[model samples]
Target: MDTREKILKAAAEMLAEDMGAKLSVRAVAARAGVSTGSLRFHFPTQRALQDSLLARIYEHLLPGDPIRDPALPPRERLLNCLRQVLALIGTNEDARTAWGATYRTFIEPEPTEQLRAAYLRHEREAERRVEHWLTVLAEEGALPPGDHTRNLRFLLTILNGLSVERALPTSQSVFLAEAETLNAAVDFVLSAGPASPVESTQP
Candidate 1:
């Protein structure tokens, strides 16, 4: 693979496999089978390498691609989008660890600017995706009369919080039970919006 691809792969592996590992230039160089000079040539600093890795992770999580179920109605599409986004909140152990570390770095008062900025960007992208999906449903007249963006932020925050709780032992059961919230959220969204054909066609 090319140098850029090698760096990205090395970075991703390092991030996934060694979240606690201090990502030094030499460390990444060794991982990629490249020289420290070569790695530095591509990424001038450790923070730069991490920012690149975070960007790659963000792309993997949400590429901004259109919804996969093209034939579904706008309400279904919106709900599907919400489900997919919520599913990113570390459902499994590895994911839980990765996101936990990420959130730590984000909340730290002394993390490098690169890490903080990258996380802020990721959060913005997340909000935009949620807001965009909400807007789509609103335009289609599928949402109820509340402030969609604020309501979306409220719900997405709950999903993120639940993901964190699931990472801990005492709250795992609570998080599992909260699947009902996701179901209730869909019902609320649909009921608040314009009637679905499913609704209108019912005898």
Candidate 2:
């Protein structure tokens, strides 16, 4: 394999083995059997390397992301993408287990600097993914121009709430309520300003 590919492979493997392990230049270089200089030549900075690794993970998680499909209405495409994010959180026992693990690992005990950094890195990655979706819809003229950062935060806030709901007991089906909430959130953003006229596909 090529030098760059080898470095990425080594990095991915390291992460798979232990998601919390730091991907330091020296460590990745050693794992890849390449010189630090070579790894630097390919990645230049730690952020560059991490971003590439996360992009690979995201692509694997959502190959041919629905947000990019022109055949579907933009609203429907965005909903599909958001639903996929929730799917990763799972439901019922799966969601409860995830929450329990998170609390034990990061909350029950004093979190170390390394642990905090890992959590922040994950949060930033979520923000990045959400921003990418908003950008795509704006480009399609299906969404109005606005402060994308604010919009991203707003959307993620709703998602975080929905994820928590998945872990809790409820008398009614959360799926139907989740869809209504997602639709309302999408509508609010789409109506924030005058979007370039696009043909309506919504019933």
Report the number of the highest-lDDT candidate.
2
Candidate maximizing TM-score: 2
Model 1: per-residue Cα lDDT over 139-200, one tens digit each: 66666544666556666776676666666666335644666766677677566653323345
Error of 2 at 106 (Å): 3.4
Q: Report the C-alpha lDDT of model 2 over 34-123, residue by residue, as the tens digit.
A: 999999999999999999988988778767788988789988888898999998889998999877777765677678898888778878
Q: What's the lDDT for candidate 2?
A: 0.86
Which residue runs does candidate 2 get wrong by more than 4 Å? 111-113, 169-173, 193-203
lDDT of each: 0.67, 0.86
Model 1 lDDT at residue 32: 91
Give the TM-score of each candidate: 0.55, 0.82
- Clash counts for the predictions, in order: 1, 0
Taking all chains together, the TM-score of candidate 1 against the true structure is 0.55
Q: Which lDDT value does model 2 have at 120?
A: 83
